[model samples]
Structure formats: structure tokens, C-alpha cells
Target: MIIRPRPHWIHLLFVRRGSLLPRILSQQIFVLLLSCAVVVVHGQLFHWKVTLTSAPFSLMGVALAIFLGFRINASYDRYWEARRLWGTVLIEGRNLARHALTLTGGGVDARPFVLGLIAFAMAMRNQFRGRPRQEGLEGLLPAETVARVQAARCAPALILLWLGQWLQGVREAGHLSPMLAQHMERSVDELSAALGGCERIANTPLPFTYTVILHRSSYLYCMMLPFGLVDTIGWMTPLVVGFVSYTFFALEALSDEIEEPFGTMPNDLALDAIVAGIEASLRELLGETPAPAPQPDAAFILN
Candidate 1:
């Protein structure tokens, strides 16, 4: 996502890289022009004056602001939960890697097991973003394992299955006791739960009808605002309408951008960076040299 040092107050007002202004600029301009036209005509249409008062708009604005607040809160909840689930994945992946190295009695090669944890994280990232499984798995996993994951309907779930099989094989080979294997198995189960949580959030979004109603209401309120203020504010009606419309439009766009936290939007969670960090941490746990951490782009977007 947009990761950068906070800008100065004046720069904050004019910053365009991560702002939502670009997405709603056209709408704001249209509303400003409409407001200007209404003011020029003195709130008249076809020789008939459209009389309106600010009192109703004041009440509607209050209600609309409250509803928009609720919508944004709901979207932020999803975004935060998704981030927490990834945090769980990172933690559990580290735990599994440590277990693979220490608890296997040094008789079993832990590289494959550690690599499986990384593969699971990559597969989950790809699945959430609707990408193909083979993008980065060829180098991390065996060809047969990658083939199995690619062919499976759920690549992350399949990788988890392979992980379980590895634990079982280690136990059977006398490299690990049954109790220790079960302990590592619990970490794998935690990874599974995290995977399922991410799946639920990705598959089930906020209801479409709710989004439609909120979108229509925001536009309707902005479009009808100029007439209400024209009679009272006179020449300043366009300026007032422009500012108000910008607030409503920007909030609506922000909600839409963050509703699906796994997306490639500037505001969405940085799944690419998150997956890379997980891989790096796991490799470090295995005493291997991890790759460099991902750097943000020139625009300060990490994904």
C-alpha cells in the first residue's frame, strides 16, 4: 500500500500520488459546473424557479454522513482482519520452520519442510489475488508438488496437505516423536485456519445491494445540493457545492478501494510485500540467507 513518511501540511493539501482526488475529479468538476449553472439561473429550470431550503439538506447531510461513516467502518474492519490473518500466517510459518529444524532430531532434512511453509504462504497470496499458482512456486517446491498444487482447486489447501504429509513422514521415519510431531502439526493447523480466514474474507464481500444504495444516495445528495444552496449562498454556491461534493465522493471512493483488501489498489493491503517478508523470516529461521526485503515504488506503493 501507500507507505511513505508523512508530508508537510501544505504538501498534504496538494499531494496527488496517494490521494483519492484523481478518481473523483471529474465528478467534482461536473458538480461544480452544475452548481454554477444553478446559481446563474437563480435556481430556476425552464422558466420555473425550484425553491428549496438548506434545512432539509442539513438533516440529510447528517444522516448521509452517519451512513457513510458506518460504511467506511465496515470496510476498514475487513481490511484490518485480513491483515491480522496474514500476521498469523507469518507467525505460524516461523514456528513451523523452527520446529522443522530443532524437533526433527537432525536426521531429516528440514529444507523441504521450511520451503513448504514458504510455498504455502505464496500459494495463499496468489489465491487471494486470483493469480496463477505457478508464478513463483517452481523455484521453491519440487516439480511434482508444484504440479499437484497447480492442479488442485485450492492451491493453498493443497500445500497445507503436503505439509501435513511431511510431518507424518518425519514421524514415521523416527526423526521425530509422536508428541513433537503433534506439536508441529498444531502450528500447521493454525496456518490452515489462517488460510481459511483469508479465503472467507476474499470470497464474501460486503453485500452488493448495500453498496448500490450507498453509492446512489451519495451521488443524489451531491447532485441536488447546489439547488438547495443557490438561493441562500448566491455566487458562492458553486464553491460550497464543490467542497461538499468532494468530501462525499472521496469517502465513497475510499470505501470502495479498501473493501477488498487483497486487491492491487493503492489502499489495499500489500500482499506481495507481506508474502516476501514471510519468506524472508522463515529462511532466516532456517539459517539461510534471506532475500532482500521489498522496497516501495517511486509513488510509495509497496504492491
Candidate 2:
């Protein structure tokens, strides 16, 4: 996701990196050219003067803006919900690492449990981003464990199973008492719930019909806007249409990008950085030097 510092107002007006302008530029240009043609023809088609007025467009624009606002709010809700789920994953991961280190008796190596948490986070990220299940698991987990996770249909769920098994082994070996094991198991359950939440969001998107209706409405409104305004605004129709179309197009594009927060879009969630942070926190809890935190790229984007 875009992670740059806020810029000055003047620079912000021209900023391209994280803005929806790039995505909607083509639509904006098309609307501008269409408006120019309408103005040139004086809102006529085949020698027939198309009698139109801005009254209908004004009313329609208001309704369209309201619907676009609603769509954007819905998309943002999904994005924020995904971020909260990842936050829970991080918190529960840290809790699990701490329980493995302090709650368990001595000589119980907590590294494996902590590593499993890291692997789980990676698996979730890969699953959401539609990447290979075993893309980044080799160095984080044992060969056998990696193979098991790779083989499983749900890699994150399998890693959670392994984590539960590790806790059970600790309890069986007398390192973790039953009570403490149950307490730690609560964290595991929380992790499971968080993973389930992410999966739900990833699987169920905003209704396809709703999106299709909005998409068609936005484009149709822009396409016909020039005819409505050409007679009223004359040569200024193109400029007005360009500005209005840009607003509508940009909003639609922004909503599309953020609707699926797990995507690789510039506006999507920073899954790689989030998983890395979780790994660092768990490793630090285990008394190991955490890897350096991820930095945004030259364009100030963290994937």
C-alpha cells in the first residue's frame, strides 16, 4: 500500500502515485473528447438537434454521487475489516510466542511454535493474494512440516493444527500444565477465528450485480453528460465534462481497487510488511534478533 508522508497541498494536487487518476485517465480523456464533439455538433445527431437540458443531469448526478459514496464506504469497510483481522493475527501471534517462552517450563524450545506462527501468517498472505501455497514456507518451517502444509488445501488452517499439536506435546512432556495449555489454546483459537474472518472477506465480496449496476451507471452517465450540457455550457462543455467525469471515474476506480484489500494494487493492504512485522515481533519475543523491518520502495509503496 502507499505509505508516503503527506505532501504539500500544491504537490498533492499533482501527485500520481497512490491517486486514482492514472486508472481513470483514459475514461476522462474519452469523456472530454466526446464533450468536444457534442459541442462542435451543437448537440445534434444526423441533422436532428437533440434537445436536452442540464436539469435531468443535475438530478442524476446527485443520485449517482450518493450511490458512488455508498459503494466507496462499503469497499472501505472491507479494507478496514481485513486490516483489523491481520492486526488480530499479529496480536495473537505475539501472545502465543510469549506463552511458549514464559508459561512453559525450561528446555522447551519455543522457536518451533514461533516459527509456525510466522509460517501461518505467510500462508494466509499467500492464500489471500492467490500465490502458491508454499511460496515462502521453505526457510520458515521444517521440510516435513512445509510438505504437510503444502499438501493441505488450507495451509493456514493446517499450520494452526500444528500449533495446537505443539502445545499438546508441551503439555504431555510436563513443560506446560494443562491449565496453561488451555490458556495458550485460547490464543490459538483467536488465531483460528481471525483466519476464518480473513477467509470470509476474501471469499465473499460485494454483490456482483451491485458492482455491475454501478459500473454501467457511471459510464453511461458520463457518456451522455456532454449532450446534456453542450447547449447550456457551449464550448465550456468539454472542460466541465472532463472535471465531472474525472470525479466519477476516479471514485469508481478507487472503490474497485480497495474492494479486495488483499490484491496487489497500490491501494491494497500491505500484507508482506504486515506478515514481516509479525515475524519480527515473535522472533524478538523468543530472544532472537528480529529481521530488519520492511521499508517502502522508492515510490513509497509497501506491497
Number of the top TM-score candidate: 1
Measured against the true structure, the TM-scores of the candidates, in listed sequence, are: 0.96, 0.95
lDDT to native, each model: 0.88, 0.88
Writing each residue's lDDT as its tens digit, candidate 1 over 203-264 gives 89999998899999999998889889987889999999888998999999999889999998
Measured with C-alpha atoms, the lDDT of residue 239 in candidate 2 is 88
Q: Distance from true position, residue 49, model 2, in Å?
A: 1.3
Cα TM-score of candidate 2: 0.95
TM-score, model 1 to reference: 0.96
Model 1: lowest-lDDT 10 consecutive positions: 294-303
Candidate 2 stretches with Cα past 4 Å from truth are: 298-303
